[model samples]
Target: MTGPATDVWTVMSTARTIRRFTDKPVDEATLGRCLRAATWAPSGANAQEWRFVVLRSPESRAVVAKAAEQALRVIEPVYGMTRPDDHDDSRRARTNRATYELHDRAGEFTSVLFTQKRFPTASELLLGGSIFPAMQNFLLAARAQGLGACMTSWASYGGEPLLREAVGVPDDWMLAGHVVVGWPQGNHGPVRRRPLADVTYLDRWEEQAGPTLVTEAPPS
Candidate 1:
């Protein structure tokens, strides 16, 4: 709510992954508001045993930055991330550039660590059923507040020990996600996505939800 109030549909439709950010820092009030939004998300069995840790101080962010660097080593190779030049105008190249830039500047952004209480019988994916919705709420709230955010895997990659030690996470808490938030240096989205007709199904898995779209419709 730090920014002007936006309609729900507009907010949902425009929300997209934002990796590039400005030098401006997100204030405490705005961050708290987004965290409040996260609390509104539903969890399996209504356990609501989620916690969020914020790293904003220089010392803490330095730790996050170190973790981000470690994560990039794993990310870059596996994803075949390449450095893009001024001449490179392709979509993939641009995306890669943004990814790298975010890692390089991670220390400057405010990072949030989301955690859920560990349950004896639950798998990680199953545990995510309780936490991912809260995380989504966090993302949407950030987008609504005119803040740019990107969820990172720094804590899940080779960074678990580093971040856990830096944040002093309890043994019972599992790190669900890491997200960086800041004022965007780039533009917001009219996000690109596949048409609904391409993804939806009707009453059954085998049924098409919309008219069939054949590429190059046979000579009319």
Candidate 2:
């Protein structure tokens, strides 16, 4: 287990979203640890309405991959479009390109953790507040073991019906997302982000705080 002395900040700073994974196998014991961490996350009123279904068999992965491809076909066009403001064109293009690349490679990972939750009624729009944190906890736990993972909501796009039936999830449950995990085909490194000052605000909007996200210099 990773201790407090392990510098969680560093672990968090370098935990980039990994899409291209190697052929290395992730054992059951390792995945169980990640699930344990996920269960420790706080949920709305302690309801903990989350459920994780692990997909390992090639046939199962193929189903998910096909569903994801359908989702990409529907979503990629939106990402490629020019936003009304036009200021986000470049970012949109990059995202579109990444999704395009990830489409064909989705099924090749070690495992896909299917995140699901009880269906939320119109009154409970905040249901995601409980499930998303658990997903993050699982991701960070995998990162601690030098594994790579990425969370994708493609399951909810156009393939939700097919995926729900294939995964054998009941109608009362809704898909939260999918987390694909495995060893990386490439190295893990720091993720790019805006400077903290640009995003942080003090007591009021535009009242900025000092940067708290710092990284050490690389060896020469």
Candidate 3:
């Protein structure tokens, strides 16, 4: 952890949402390091309510994978119901394709991390504030160890009782997110993003500031 090899910015910048994985398993020691990194994330008033469930057993993963598949079957139509005329067909189709691809390979993950924490109180906005940072830490730690990872909430939101019961999560806890981790099948690289100047604002409203060349535009 003492060289450019462990630089924080390098790790953060290189972390990507990896979906495809190889059959190699993640060793127990590496898993411990990732979880330990998550524990160091800050929490509200140090309440530190985040909890994680790791599934490596094929039987258990199958249960969750089946739930994810069932969930995807209904997502597009559910979005249409919620938005009606405003639903974007092209965007929805793209999302559907991505969801299906993940579902097809769900069982390949060497480890699946289920994140949960106490439900937020009415007074608090962004209830996931405490939990998500910890989840990010978990992913970054995995990335640093040369493992690929991805985080999503389809199981929590769409799979519902099936997923909850399979994992034995309590009703009092909200499912924050899920992360899939394993050896990547391909090389990793920096993801595209909007130029920082286009997204960042200065002292005045609508005023663009910061370096304009932070990233290149995605391919058209």
Q: Best candidate per TM-score, number?
A: 1
Minimum summed lDDT over a 10-residue window in model 2 is located at 211-220
Model 1 — TM-score against the truth? 0.90
State the lDDT at 77 in candidate 3. Answer: 74
RMSD, candidate 1, Å? 5.1
Q: Provide the TM-score for each candidate, comma-separated.
A: 0.90, 0.79, 0.78
> How accurate locally, in lDDT, is each candidate?
0.86, 0.71, 0.69
Among all candidates shown, the one with the greatest lDDT: 1
Off by over 4 Å in 2: 1-5, 81-101, 113-116, 119-125, 210-220
Summarize candidate 3's per-residue lDDT along 119-220 as a digit string, tens digits.
546333455787778888888898888787877666755676766788888887777777878777664557566657677677888776655443443333
How does candidate 3 fare on TM-score? 0.78
Off by more than 4 A, model 3: 1-5, 75-101, 119-125, 210-220
Ordered from best to worst TM-score, the candidate numbers read 1, 2, 3
Model 2, 1-220: lDDT tens digits are 2211235666686678877666777889888888898899888788888888888788778877887789777775865532234344675565554455567777765555445466455233477777778888888888877888878877777777767777888876667778888776566667788866677788889886654433234323
Q: Which stretch of 10 consecutive residues in model 1 shows the poorest summed lDDT?
A: 211-220
| C-alpha RMSD of each candidate structure in angstroms | 5.1, 6.2, 6.8
